[model samples]
Target: MERESDVDALIAEGAAAPVDGWAFDWLAGRAAEERPPWGYARRVATRMAAARAALDVDTGGGEVLAELPQSPPLLVATEGWPPNVTVAARTLRPVGGRVVAVTPGAPLPFRDAAFDLVVSRHPVRTDWAETARVLRPGGTFLSQQIGPGTVRELSEAILGPLPPPADRHPERAVADAEAAGLRVVDLREATLRTVFHDVAAVVWFLRKVVWTVPGFTVERHRPALVRLHDRIRAEGPFVAHARRFLVEAIRPAD
Candidate 1:
């Protein structure tokens, strides 16, 4: 059995790590999560190649957008998190992409029909109406979204049993897109296996992905963390499932 001191040290390390940007490089060897079958990044790259103007909503750190081989003439990205704006701007500099900071829930600050393509990856919330309003006629909107009950097992491990997930249903997204005057073209869902090799990984993940445990704190949840650490030492690595969905919609021609 690992010493209690070792566990405490691991927890402290995780708690001290910075949670800036959307990248998960910190969890490299300690955790693993399976990716969806559909390659969301590759899909975005393909679409972006054909777009005259493209907008990336909630483009955290512009990590994914920076990887696109080709950038549209007018490439723009929006981020609600202030710290990520500068990070995104620097990352996307080589691609000639601009990052704009905006309020989380406010309407997008852009002219109507300004973009021929819009994309988002794991947005906190989808503003379907605002997305449609900013797209040019016959433009496409593509997104990889977090599905309902995503990473619930990890959450339950930390916070105990919880209520059923009530939102982020694929059907609901289709309906919302249609209501916003966009035609849904495709939808897909995936449940991925996620494994955490150590308690530190769990703590870091919860800190970075705040939605996992609402208001998780090492001090407040020390007992639970201890229990989980013990469980990991006794049993094998803790296992969880992450759910994701991809949706595509297109604004009709004027």
Candidate 2:
């Protein structure tokens, strides 16, 4: 049995590798589909309308920003990954949104209270405080992110017993928002169940889409892969799960 600490170290290390091609393309397509006039696009638009100036954090592929109206002159986007920032700039150019790459979990480049609205999708929790710091009084902070139990089954199968829940909890995020002097008005979790052709597809998706923890050795996961394949072959089309939390909060008027 591997010690919990050992497992964590491995996952942290492996998370930086490029995600699988199939999974990356699938996510890119999903981002395009989930844009405006459809589902969350309406909500995002509504939020953007309320702000004089807007800042989008981690604007991956700029799909969310692209859906909004091209009216906000001060629209700016930041992505932590260089490649993602480059892609976002191209994707958001038509909407006149400027994209810049910045390090996650650090002070934002903008001045304090500089933005009227701050939006993020799947941003690192470490940046929550900085997000609040950058928003003006009464500014809205809207974020959508993966919650705990995201890919729980795959994680458990590959890593043995599940680890203790970390800060990814939606409740904890609400608390973090409140602690950062932001009022949490809406915090909701949406679970989406997706189907894949086979266990191999599922494994590839996890490698690319989910980005398993750093410590996960491809070699160590081979047995788990075999087991998953066997199970899927016996069970038919496999069910994969994903969860996203939609949170809308306001920086205190004071």
Candidate 3:
């Protein structure tokens, strides 16, 4: 029991630290490389090429939006992080895109039926109700998001046992869309595989890049770091497998 407690302590300590610059830089680079080619942006762009206006929620780095062949009249991007928003806006503005930095968990700033297409990649918003609320009749809502198994190994090593494996609810995004009177179109799940140079890289990514959960303090994370290093030495380089879902739904043409 003492050994188990010790291990748990180590895990917590290793995960401590506010995720900031180093983490985002590391994650941005990795996201650029390993994110699926047929990801959220492509999927949404393909479906909405004819639309007059479009919005991308949480447009990190604007890489996905940049891939579109023809830009929308209103190529608006919404970001929650001020720094990231500034960076993304700087990168995207050259291409005639506009950026809006919003407070987290707040309703989006758009009129009803304002957009013909709305897309998001791993949006931090708990539910898609707002997404559905903002879409015009016949507008499309497309998203690709990380599911529950996003960092199973890391979570286990650092945070102790995790909840039982279950399909990510995405806060009932689908149901929210339906309640808003959107028609369910298509939904699919894919397992994504990512390789890390080392366990430290993986840990760095979880802390910096992913930033899924908050409240990791340095004292809490130190022991976890030690355990992770020891585990890596024992187990060899880390390979992370994550489950992601791609969902597409459309507002009915009334």
Candidate 4:
């Protein structure tokens, strides 16, 4: 049972795979996920072109921040994990932005009214109060966030059926931003197709994207992995839906 070559490959590749940055190129052929039409990276680059000062929160390895077409005059990014902090600093240096290792859920290290634009792709948790505290009046906040029940199919494959998502709704984001004194000008949500061609792809995915199934390991979830492998071989590809939301808010000029 444990000596299956395909399963062994899956476990070995996943366990050895690098899960440092936010980039997902490793999943290119083995897995695929549709992109949101709104183009969050393009939006972020546009915002960066206009803003003098900006902050990128929870910038995993600063990979996304490094992709900005034009760098802002004062750009800063934050990461909570120590390993990611090192990686982020290296990646962000060329863009002239520094990565600050911050404590998750702690107050941001920056002073009040320090930045005119604040952006994050998918933060662990959005501290609206800190976001509002750092953003200057009339500043903009643009983010593409993970929505409720993203990749539920993959999740259930790993951990069996689960309850609906409780935390990641976009409506709650609007309320929080509003409470933080930011005007929510736009909100959009999308559910996109996601597919895994093989068990290794799924294994690598879960290992890299920890939130999919925290503490997942080949030894721990071998049975589930075997079942999923069988399903992929019988069917074409394991299909799932990924949901994401985009929110654009502005701090009032007043």
Once fitted onto the true fold, the runs of candidate 2 whose alpha carbons sit more than 4 angstroms away are: 1-38, 215-220
Model 3 scores what on Cα lDDT? Answer: 0.67
Residue 111 in candidate 1 has what lDDT? Answer: 95
Candidate 2 Cα deviation (angstroms), residue 218: 4.2
How should the candidates be ordered by lDDT, best one leading? Answer: 1, 4, 2, 3
- Where is the poorest 10-residue window by lDDT in model 3? 21-30
lDDT of 1 by residue, 1-254 (tens): 55889899989989999888899999999999999999999999999999999999999999889899999999999999998998999999999999999999999999999999999999999999999999999999999999999999988987899999999999999999999999999999999999999999999999988898999999998888888888998998999999999999999997
Candidate 4, residues 29-148, lDDT tens digits: the string is 899999999999989999899999999999998888888879999989999988899999999999899889889999999999999999999888899988989999999999999999
Task: Quote each prediction's TM-score.
Answer: 0.98, 0.80, 0.80, 0.97
Candidate 1 accuracy as TM-score: 0.98
Model 3, span 35-73: residue lDDT tens: 555566666667656768888888866767766777777
Error of 3 at 246 (Å): 0.5
Expressed as tens digits, the lDDT of each residue in 121-204 for candidate 2 is 777654667878899998888888877777666677667777765758888888888888889998778767655544434444
Give the range where candidate 1 is weakest over 10 consecutive residues by summed lDDT. 1-10
Clashing pairs in 2: 10-214, 10-215, 11-213, 11-214, 11-215, 12-214, 14-214, 20-208
